[model samples]
Target: MTGANGVPEGFVPLPTSAFVEHLGGLYHAPEAPEHTFGMRVGPEHANVRGRAHGGFLATAVDVATSRGARAAMGDGSGVSTVTMTMDYLAPVDVGEWIQLVTTVDRVGGRTVFATCRVTAGDRLVARGSVVLARIRPRA
Candidate 1:
């Protein structure tokens, strides 16, 4: 079960609350704890032309940004996505596990900035930046 890096291969890397639970639709990072999101590529999320859908890429970025903010703020941080911009660099094939890395650039009293990248086997498939606003919990 060792992966290429010597880590256990095929082992679900993320927590149960992360992506696998959602059937590759969503995922979260435990180290960040501030964010939770998931990504999908390959055939399950491809377009009719057989390329990864642009909308899915954007959603992944947005989810990562929001989850990262949540991780930073902790439970009940009341963060919400305000804006997201994504750039599709290359086409991705089905069955390839797309890797997503999200980083929180800044966390202010009212806003958060995050960046994420989607890659397939060392090739960049998409990249994005997202802005989120922190709000008060609903009554």
Candidate 2:
């Protein structure tokens, strides 16, 4: 994180104007090891149990992994997620801040693999892996 509520270096915040903005304060930094992301838990992101919903966590993983893929592919190569898998290990409550650390595992001819781990401070909350297939260039 840079300053007050600022994202990490090379990371960008997903403003309220974007679709995933509903996730609330999502951010991602594509740099190695810095493939980092953060979001503060809010009321809307919680479930009846008052903890962050599974969907919310899953969505965050998707956003982080997908964007990290783009950074890995650079300017020209295109990719789209083919599958994603996540494991929930703990719950996150409102007012808590969670960060997603992701890495591009591999980029083959037609597939890319990414993995993410979500944590609240040092507590592991969730882990995810995503597979993205190359998108054919238009003629």
Candidate 3:
């Protein structure tokens, strides 16, 4: 099922900062844990070259995979990216709805490792991996 704006049915808009809100609305897919994050590409997301900017895509991946890692922490803990790498496979055009499909590779006491594939429809547009440091509350 899909939403009115073509967003998938299970996805709900995620509250974000002004910068992210301007980039494009972020979505959380609660029903599909693997597909925890998503966003729709708009003309504003395009670069001067008329494709989705690499920086924007990188930001989306970082946010999405960090959410995956945080969920793996299993204590409602937050996470900060320790390191991240992204490989651009294809150019995503405006009007494409992209999904960030993530896998939690490993979970440890202080760190989590995860990978995400950015897909636009049937195309795999990018892949990213991240190592996140668990952010525990100061006690």
Candidate 4:
């Protein structure tokens, strides 16, 4: 029951930028209560110690929280991270598949707050909180 490239059966490619594309592959499972984002760590994502870099884990959290904010705000409402705080709980090694479970904490008139738990396989690796400014187009 695996999808393309062996991602979980429910996950599909998420909307992303060139920078995210460079991170290997990103997937999303919208059917989850709090949408899940996933990626398999690659050699380039590792630090000199051969562990997944903090920057890479930060990016994963950022993307998950940002997307969670946008989903909470509904379609046509874009979001930009205003503040992000991350707690590194454990180290993840290269080649491990990591998944981020994002939950929207609140959605206000012009901002959204979200949090995420990052896991590699069954081990919790990180947790993050993000505040996103909602961007709406002017008429």
In candidate 3, stretches whose alpha carbon ends up further than 4 angstroms from where it belongs are: none
Q: On residues 64-115, what C-alpha lDDT tens digit does candidate 1 reach at each position?
A: 6666667666747767788888889998876665667777898888888888
Better of 1 and 4 by TM-score: 4
Query: What TM-score does structure 4 among the candidates reach?
Result: 0.92
Could you give candidate 2's per-residue lDDT for residues 1-139 as a string of tens digits? 4556644456566553366775666765545465777887889989999999999999888888876777667757677779999899998998777888878999888889999999997899999999988764666
Q: What is the lDDT of residue 5 in candidate 1?
A: 41
**lDDT of all predictions:** 0.67, 0.80, 0.86, 0.87
Q: Please provide the root mean square deviation of candidate 3 (C-alpha atoms, Å).
A: 1.7
Candidate 2's error at 49, in angstroms? 0.5
Clashes of 3: 0
Ranking by lDDT: 4, 3, 2, 1
CA lDDT of 15 in candidate 4?
Answer: 74
State which candidate has the highest TM-score.
4
Clashing pairs in 4: none
Question: CA RMSD for every model?
Answer: 4.5, 2.8, 1.7, 1.5
Counted clashes in each candidate structure? 16, 0, 0, 0
- Please identify which of the two predictions, 1 or 3, would achieve the higher lDDT against the true structure: 3
lDDT leader: 4
Which tens-of-lDDT digit does each residue in 19-57 have in candidate 4? Answer: 888887688987877779999888999999999999999
